[model samples]
Target: MNRSACLIFNPVAGQGDSEQDLAMIRAILEPEIDLDIQLTTEEISAEELAHEAVRRGVDTIIASGGDGTLSAVAAAVVSTDISLGIISRGTANAFATALGIPDTIDAACQVILQGVTRTVDAADCNGHRMVLLVGIGFEAEAVERADREAKNRFGVLAYILAGLQELRNLHSFDVEIETEDKIIKTSAVAVTVANAAPPSSVLAQGPGGIIVDDGLLDLTIVASLTRAGAIAAAFHLFQTASAGNGAERNDIGYLRAKQFKITTEPPQKIVVDGEILGTTPVEIRCIPAGLKIFVPSREEEEAVEKLEGLPNLTIEEKPSPENSPD
Candidate 1:
C-alpha cells in the first residue's frame, strides 16, 4: 500500500543546500510514497503545516530540519496516529543522533522508505511540546551564546565555544524543584530535564541511561559552585554519558519523575529542544507513549550499532514492532 507523507522543511536549518536536499529526498521517497514537500517560512509554520497534513490524513509527516523543526512537527502529531519522520539538517541534530537516525540525506530518506515505527514518550513544558531535553542555567546560557551566525560559521563547534565562554561566568542560583514525591531546594549551576537525549548530552546522563519510552523524565542538576568544580563536574558527566551509566559524582544530582515544577530565585533562561524560550518557573509533565516515530529496523539497527561508538543512552529495551503507533 502506498503511504502519503508531507515533508515540512526548514529552509535555513544547518548549512545545506535546501533545494538539492529536497530533490534528493523526493527522489528517494516518491517512488514508494506519495510525498508532498512544504517549506517553512517562520518559526512555528512547521507546526501549522503539520497540523494541516494531519487534517489531510497523511500517513506520515516528516520534519526536514533540526531538533526545533522536528519538535514543532511532533507537537502537531502527538497522541495522533500519524507517524513522524526525520531528516536531520540541524547543527546538533541531537534528537536524530539519539534515535540512530542518519544525518546523510540518502540514509535518512532510506529510513523513511523502510517505514518502521516506534512509540515513544513526549512532554509538555508550559504550553509547548517537548521532544528533547530542556536546559536551565549554564546550558541555557551556552545556547544563547551560540547564535545563528556562530552556528552557521562553526557548526557544532559553536556550541562548545559558547559553552566554554559560559563556563567562565558560571554562577549558581537558588532553585526549587517540585515533583510528586519530594521538593528539592538547592543552588545549582545547571539543570537538565530530558524526555529524550543522546549520549552527547552529558548533563542528562544517569545510572540507567535515558529511557525515552519509560513514561518519565530524566532530570540532572549540577550544583558545583567554583569554576574548577563545575568544569570537573562537566567532565564527570561527559564520562558518565560516554559509558551509558548513571552519574557517580557527588556534585551531580539525578532523578526521574513523571512531572516537575522548577522555580529559580533569579529567573533563569530556558532552552527547550534548542530554542531559547524565555525565563523559567516552568512546569513540565510527561505523556507516555505519546509520539509515533519512524526508526530503523532491527537489522539496520544492528548494522548502525556496529559503526557507532556510543549507545543511544536513551533506549532501554529493544524497539519492538508491538510498540508501533495505533
Candidate 2:
C-alpha cells in the first residue's frame, strides 16, 4: 500500500497558519506515503512544481491550497495516470467542497491515504485549464473586486460584499452561444460554464446537481435582473441546487454541452477557477475523465449524500501498485 506523492503546498493561499498546516499535512501523510513536500513561492509556482513532479514520474500530486492552486496543479496532472489530492486551504475551497472532500488537514489527508479516487471531467478554456466553473459578467466583476488584500481581511465575506455592491449596477449584454447542435443568441447579465461546482455556486446549478463525471459542462445564463430580481434568482437557483428542483423562472436559462463557443458584445471579464483570466469571446471544450482525484467513497461520504440534493460521486478504480510510477 505504499505510494510516492509530491505535495504542492501554497503557503499564502488562505488566512491560516501555513507552518502548522504544512506540519500537520506532513505528519498525517508522511507516515502513510513517501511524501515529498514542495512549497509554492513567487519564484516557483504550483503549476511549475506539479510539472516537475509529473516529469519525475511521481505516483500522485497532492495540492494543498485553495481552488486556484488545486486547479493549477490539476492542469499539469490532467490526462496522466497520477492521482490528484486536495487539502482545501482556500477561502472558498469550492472544488473541494463540491466533491465533499474534508477541509481539515487531517481529514483531507486521510481521504488521500484511503486511496479512493475518481476520474472527473476537466475543461480547456481558450487554452487555459479549468477544473471548476468559468464565470463571466456579474460573477467576474465580483471575483475581480475581491482581491488578495480584501480576501485576507474579510475571508469569504469579501466575495459577498463585492457581489452586493455589483448587484446594484447590473447591466445586460448581447451573447451568442454556439454548440455542436444549436446556436442560441440572447442577452444576459451573467453566464456560468461549470464542470464541477458546489451548491453555493447557485448560477452553475442549471440542472440542480452538476454531475462531475458526466463528460459535459453545465451552462447557466441569467438575464438582466433588478437588485431584487437578482436576489430572487439566486435564491431560486440555490433551491434548485439544494432540492433538485428546476430553475422555475423564465429569466434563467440552462443547457449542457461538450463544447461551447460564446461571443459577447463588449468583452466581459472571465474568472476561471477563481482567477480572473481574461475577457470573453472564448471557446471551451470538456475533457472527459481527464483528471483522477482522491475523494471519499460513497459509503464513506454518507454524511454529505443527502445534505444538498447533490448528485452521486463518480467512483473510479482505486490506484494500485501496478499503476504507480517509478
Candidate 3:
C-alpha cells in the first residue's frame, strides 16, 4: 500500500463522536499510510478537501462518511488518478455496501492495508457527478423527507417511514425518456439511474444485484399507483428477466441503457445518493470506470466467481476522463 493518504472524516456521522473511531483508524493506518485528517462540516467541504488532497499529490483519498460524503469526494476525483477508500459511518452507507466495502471502520482499513483497487463506472447527472445512484419521482421525494429527520435520531428506518409516506400520496407523472435508440413516454412513480447494482441498500447484505464493472447503467423505473401494485409489478418484471427481455408494464417501465435524456411535464426532484439535487430535463450518461474504488473481499470474490459462470460475458475498462455538463 502507498504511504501517502488523505482521510476525509465527517465528525457528525454515525452513532456518536466519529473522532473516537477516527483516532483508532489512524492508529491502525499510521504504520502503512500517511493519514491527513480533514473534518467535514458542510457538503462542499468534501470536494474542496478532495481537490486539495489531489493537489498535494496524495495517492489515495479516504471518504470517511456516509454515501453522500463518498459521492462528493468521488466527484472531485472524476478525471484524477487518485484511488478512493471507504469508511461507512453514515446513516445509509449505500456506496460502501455497493462496493462490497465492509461496514466496520477496522475492516475497511484492513482492505486499505491490502491495497486492492478496482475501477467502476460513474454517471453525470446533468453537471453533478454521482458515485452511487440517482433517484427520481417518489424516491427523490422520499429522500428529501428522510433527509429532514435522517440527520437526527432517525436511522434507515427514517427512509422507510418516508418511503411509505411518499407511497401514501403517490401519483404517476407524465414523462419522456429518450435513449440512443428509443423514446418512451410513460407515467411513472419512481425512476432510479444506477451505476452499480442492487443499490447501496441491497449491497449491504453481502450479495446483491448487477456488477459495477458491466459498463452499463441500470435504469429501474416504477410506474404504479398503490404500494401493493408496485410489489406485483416487480414480480411481473422477473418473469421477463427469465426470458432475457425487459418488460414495460402499462404502469411500470424498467430498462437499462447507457445514455438517457429525460423531460417531465412539471420538473421532478432528483436525488443523487441521499441528497436531493435539482429537477428534470436532465441528461445522464455512464462514464465507464470513471473512478477507482476499493471493493471488499466478498464483492471481489463474488465477481470473480460469477465471471467463470458466464459463457457470454464482455468486460471492458473505460479510463477516459469523464466529462460533466457545464
The TM-score leader among the candidates is: 2
Over 1-326, each residue of candidate 3 has an lDDT whose tens digit, in order, gives: 54878898878776757768888889899888878888888564887898888899877899888777788898888767888888888777777766778888888899888888888888888988877777778878878888735656777778777776776777778889998899988777777777764332421111124557767777777777787886566566555554545564676555668888888877899888677888997888888889988766555546645465687878897665665444
For each candidate, give its TM-score against the true structure.
0.90, 0.91, 0.83
Q: lDDT value for candidate 1? A: 0.88
Q: Rate the local accuracy (lDDT) of all candidates.
A: 0.88, 0.89, 0.75
Q: Which runs of model 3 end up more than 4 angstroms from their true locations?
A: 42-44, 197-208, 231-250, 297-300, 303-326
Cα-based lDDT at residue 134, candidate 1: 91
Predicted model with the maximum lDDT: 2
Residue pair clashes in candidate 3: 223-251
Query: For all the candidates, what are their Cα RMSDs to the real structure?
Result: 7.6, 7.9, 10.2
Instruction: Give per-residue CA lDDT, model 1, range 1-326, as digits (tens).
Output: 77888889998888989888888888889888887888999655888999899898887899999777888898889989989999999998898987778888788888888889999999999888899889999999999999999999999999989988988898999999999999999989999999998877777775437888999998999999888988788888888777767777788998999999999989999999888998889998999999999988879887644434666545457768889777
Q: Is candidate 1 or candidate 2 better by TM-score?
A: 2
Q: Rate residue 292 of model 1 by lDDT.
A: 92
Candidate 2 lDDT trough over 10 residues, lowest sum:
304-313
TM-score of 2: 0.91
Instruction: Rank by TM-score, highest first.
Output: 2, 1, 3
**Residue 216, candidate 1: C-alpha displacement in angstroms:** 0.6
